[model samples]
Target: MLIKVRFFKCGILQCNVVLNEGDIVTIWIDPKRVFLVKLAKGKRLDTDKGYILYDDIIGKEYGDVLKLSRATAYLLRPILEDIYLDLKRPSQVLYPKDVAYMIYSSSVEPGSVVIEAGTGSGFLTISLAHFLGKEGKVITYDVRRDMQETAKFNASVLNLQDRIEFKLKDIREGFEEKGVDAVFLDMPSPWEVVEKAYEALKPSAALIVFVPTVNQVEKTYLEMEKKGFVEIHAEELILREYKVKEGATRPKNVGITHTGYIIRGRKSIKTS
Candidate 1:
């Protein structure tokens, strides 16, 4: 996949470059330090190691190693997890681990009418839009216009603007659209919107809530039960890393231990 590379000076100032197909490039200024970078042709990127000419990487594939002027080498392609964590988030963004779980648990697919509340930095919105495709619709709501605008910018950047609908209304009252396949709640008081979600979702539709605290999770769970939801389940994901080297291969002592808990349930379908 073609990608753009951003070089950081002292881990602050950034210089961006684009990489074309079959490009081999060093992504880090210091070979010793790990950094995210892309490959491109006819571009020269300056680094402490040396000037890395884009031509050097023109024939390399993704994950290929490229050496700098000082003969120091770094990885060429950006990992999806790295890109998701490195997004420009002006608000609390959903972590990739949670996103993966949500997408899997919700069973979101093409042509799914997914409704998401509180478009916080558009991370989840982008993920959902990508998974939904052209046949799907992502109706996202944020009370703040600024947040909506930011999300719109992010969606456009990812070429997912067409699949998303940005609404500036508070979803606590209720969503205007009906017959949604799934509902994802990322707001502070998701319990307050349970009824709204129930009303908007189709019978047997999935409802997933993301909350930072167990208290919120418990409250949301009770609300779902009270609102006639079924098959309720909740889990918190803790991602640990393993250092894979010649002799060392163990879980990282400290990794992203906790982000939030996800509570999921389905609205019960009435049977005559």
Candidate 2:
């Protein structure tokens, strides 16, 4: 039953935790390749490389490796990326390269309050919750019921539902909460909500405007300026990964470019 055993004694436990039914595990095969499985009796995992029976992994230590027919996979704990990969995208979600920078630039931190509009697929909202820790809260607004429901389900799957509040009202109606640390707008015509975002944010809080086209950026930027925001800036992120080889390391041809432009501005004390 043991495929590749760790250095364990015959009588005592090798690790503090053991794999059991109803527990989620991350199966690691290679770089950028992983699978999440809910361990249960009589269940099996099939992959192009090979298949793994749950019976083999049910009692194994988390760090143990299991040999398949043609490959080996390591049993490890799940992480935020694992949860992100498993989301059901009802709309185009923001890339991690952009999400990380946007959150960091907006000064969103642990225990901070955030408000975001047009919660597309909940990827950004989920990322915010993960970064903000348990003491933080995210209020996400979406106009469509279906999209909001899907986002709620995705957050629940990742066990982040408690950190987020899903609202199905149009963001143009204005947000209910005020004095938040940050406000993120991802919907069309974020320019229309600039004043509303200004009202919701605390004094000197950041407002991030995300849009797909330069024209939209211009419109949003002008509105932000006229709305009395200060220290405004905009940026676009392009991520290109590289294939590493001992002799010929080169950048990959397929790079994620032009996902969107992120514009940041701070709420002015004059507005408060």
Candidate 3:
């Protein structure tokens, strides 16, 4: 919610946060499926079970259940997964699981200046904008306007357009920003941009790269080390979800397993 909200009680679900207009709400049909809806006065969410009017639940709290014609739905606060789950994908987007880990382990915190190369589908772009707070901004580069436009639309969905600067430029020319907090590269040849990233990062700031293959990891790590980056290492995140219930809580059969390898390095004081 954009406004200050206090504790508001609901019938079956108790919550402190009140739903507001423009707040992205998750309509939970079941554990396996959910619909992310942006709340608006006249917006109607058409579901397989039933249609829901946003006006009806604008003032309600999360965890409240909407009585539908054939089922009861839960109104939930959208998590990080929910936000990206509903994005418009024009290409193979960076998985949200890896996005979370990269941001968490990187130097790109709230209010920090960050440079991102290869703005593919804006999954990582929007995620960075959302967590960067009002003080921070993301300058993302891409060569394709269509992809960049799609990314812009996705960012607008969360009202995060103001926090991001979408630049339609080839990153191979090098990032325009100097001494930024962090540099995240999500391109096929991230090794090619290590020198550019090193040039753009502030001293001691982190440089993170995402690649899907072992050879890519090897090349990126070698480049980072050769560029005199310190604390160089790589990690791959494996996320498994569990179905929680009274007595049937267990791991889901299949989920996000291997999205990419995250290679990290800190800018060295001595440029080699």
User: How do the residues 1-272 of candidate 2 rate in per-residue lDDT, one tens digit apiece?
Assistant: 44332211111234445666766678998866688776779989888889999989987777889988788899976655675555689688888888888898999888999999989888899888877877899999998999988888877665678899888898788899999999998998999999999999999999998899999999999999999899999889988889889999999878787899999999887735
Give the least accurate 10-residue stretch of model 3, judged by summed lDDT.
Answer: 5-14
RMSD of each: 6.9, 6.0, 4.1
| CA lDDT scores, all candidates in order | 0.76, 0.83, 0.83
The TM-score ranking, best first, is 3, 2, 1
lDDT of 3 by residue, 182-257 (tens): 9999888999889989989899999989998999999999999988799998998888999789899999887889
Clashing pairs for model 1 are 19-39, 19-40, 23-57, 24-57
Cα-based TM-score, every candidate: 0.78, 0.86, 0.89
**Global local distance difference test of model 3:** 0.83
lDDT, candidate 1, at 258: 89
Off by over 4 Å in 2: 1-23, 31-33, 38-42, 58-62
